[model samples]
Target: MPSAWLSTHLRASRPRVLAALNRAFGDIDVAEDAFQEASLKALKTWQQDDIPKDPAAWLIVAGRNAGIDAFRKKRRETLTAPEDLEPVHDGVHPEEELTLSLDRSVYRDDVLRLLFTCCHPVLRRDQQIALALKIVAGLSVDEIARAFLVQPKTMEQRITRAKKRLQAARLRYEDPDGAERSARFSVVANAIYLVFNEGYSASQGSELIRETLCEEAIRLARLLVRLFPGEPELRGLLALCLIQHSRRRARLSATGQAITLEQQDRLQWDRTLIAEGIILLEAALRKATPGPLQIEAAIAATHTRAARYDETDWAELDRLYRALEIIRPSPVVSLNRAVVIAKLKGPEEALGQLEQLAAPLERYASYHATTAALLTELKQFSKARKAYEAAIQHAGTEVERQHICSKLDALRSRVPGL
Candidate 1:
């Protein structure tokens, strides 16, 4: 995964180089082309020269030279004598002096600027996320596809369409201000979270979870936090991720099976992450910014605090979900809301909710399995058997299929007629 490390470093520096080149050259195509040229040079240069002390500065210099060289070559092709067809810089501009002092434009706001550019108005939201992850985050097509729980070729087409949209609309590349930046920021966050979630869940990989991917997402979130310390929603996001990450070790059983939240070993959770999550969540809430992430973090906090499953604050969790629903409503949230109903109201009331969700729930294994589990708990063995069979039918992985099979066997054992 040396490429992974290199990619991160390179991606982190992209904005810096792109921003500087864009500022100096005043053209998006010219700046982006120069950044690509500089990246190639880094591939050749960094290995042989011990990696420049400031890689960003190195990239900026290389990119600037690239832009200048490209302009000169174009002029020669036109058979026109050079007449100051290059960037003119004023002497003593601190920015220019800083650019001079650097090994590259590593610290330049170019990467952020690049993010703003990729999520421009022309691109569809899904396409924007895909393209940004591809170009700015340095994720491969497979990686981007896995992130979105879709096929690689599908993601490839999405990104292709995104680029076409940007070209067709001729999207501008200047650093965006107030509203533009805010809108773009959401897409960037969603893209990064999507990457982290794929890595975290590993829907197709051998491992059920990849801690490194989660860590990478956490790192990205932290970087965003540093870039905008006063943003409460950002703090909520960071807080939510930290808390969930803290429970990773506790999530699996001894044989690597997926353990339900009610069954996890709380003792194995990372206190460091949990503590940090709590602190961040508190700070965010102090600003009264009650976003989805902040609410989710509070739910996680409630889980982390409980000494045992019986002690879990299901009532409080139910309340949190209710509040979260007010802010953001989805069938998934409604499904979760039913869990609280099962715990507090009764299996029948919860079953009503499940039945209400049948249109959306029919294809999902967890939805079927959860319905079956509730039936089993209610001693409705006949109904439970049917639900378990459905779970097996739709199960995405062998592990899930096996789990459902076990549930079916238990339900069959309880049935007398057969």
Candidate 2:
């Protein structure tokens, strides 16, 4: 129990722990390695002695000292073991040490600085997510790989390459400003959303949702909102995450299979999150800037508002999707808009829109899945079967493949065709 508690504490405290270590050591890799070493020490020591009053402060001190020793050893310089450092006597507060460890004003906030570092522009989006999950969100390589639908070794290599790229860039631990700051903010926000999306509908693995990734993204989004309190888009981003995550319980069936939105039990949703998300979205709309995130949040809010599937405001939802399409044009956006069209107009119209997307979305499993769903509704069972098969081939996870197989089998039984 103590170990589990310590593990949870370390994970929650990781950003601060890592930021303090980076402040002392000046290398992201060193900070991560030092924090890991300190975590091991805490597992051994906390069982005997009571956990420190300030665990983040404790981890920082322990990790910083470990980093210094490692750095010395790496360069073949003289080493001062942690045992040689001054020990805290019984009931003596470590306030001064904590102050010295974290008293840096180089950035507006340490966590934000660490986020910027992880989401450095040099690394690709996947690399940014991998590095941020590793360094900022405290996810294991295997966990991140599961979220990304990649092998553990592949994720490990990706994180390694990302770190190497960060080192080569020689990025500083300072808050960005000016045009550069705006660009970095966009990158950071996108990376956070990507993390949330991965968790919302895990690209791989048996689980329909990975709560850790979703929680981490929300945590980071909350931090960003605080850092930029006046930014409407950031608030919209937070609202979107809140509303989407509210359905976590309803997103999967009792047997751990994906449940479509129409089948999800709205009663199972988290009202607290929905209320908070609505409040946030309301505030964002008051700003009148009308950014892409706000539009998307509005779309999510529409779904959250409906008491039943038939009660959904299809007309309003369709308009929101069209607005989103204009703001951010892409094949995926078009596909979503088509789904809205199906709900509003008819399956025939939606099918026509989907046909145009084939050239762009041929490799996308969701495109095939959506097309298959529309075709099945139209009673074009043979065409639906082909689409379902294509979807199965491109499915990202075992659960997805199984879901598509079930659909295909149902269609085959009804249609009496290959």
lDDT at 382 for candidate 2? Answer: 79
For model 2, how does the per-residue alpha-carbon lDDT over 161-233 read when each residue is reduced to its tens digit?
A: 9888888887765545666776666677888988888778743654533787889899989877876767788
Q: List the residue pairs that clash in candidate 2.
A: none
Give the per-residue Cα lDDT of candidate 1 at 114: 65
| Maximum-lDDT candidate | 2
Error of 1 at 76 (Å): 3.4
lDDT of each: 0.72, 0.81
For model 1 the local lDDT of residue 355 reads 93
**For model 1, what is the error of residue 413's alpha carbon versus the real structure, in angstroms, after optimal superposition?**
4.0
Q: Per-candidate TM vs. native?
A: 0.79, 0.83
Model 2: lDDT of residue 374? 98
Which candidate tops TM-score? 2
For model 2, where is the 10-residue window of minimal lDDT? 84-93
In angstroms, give how far residue 64 of model 2 lies from its true place: 3.8
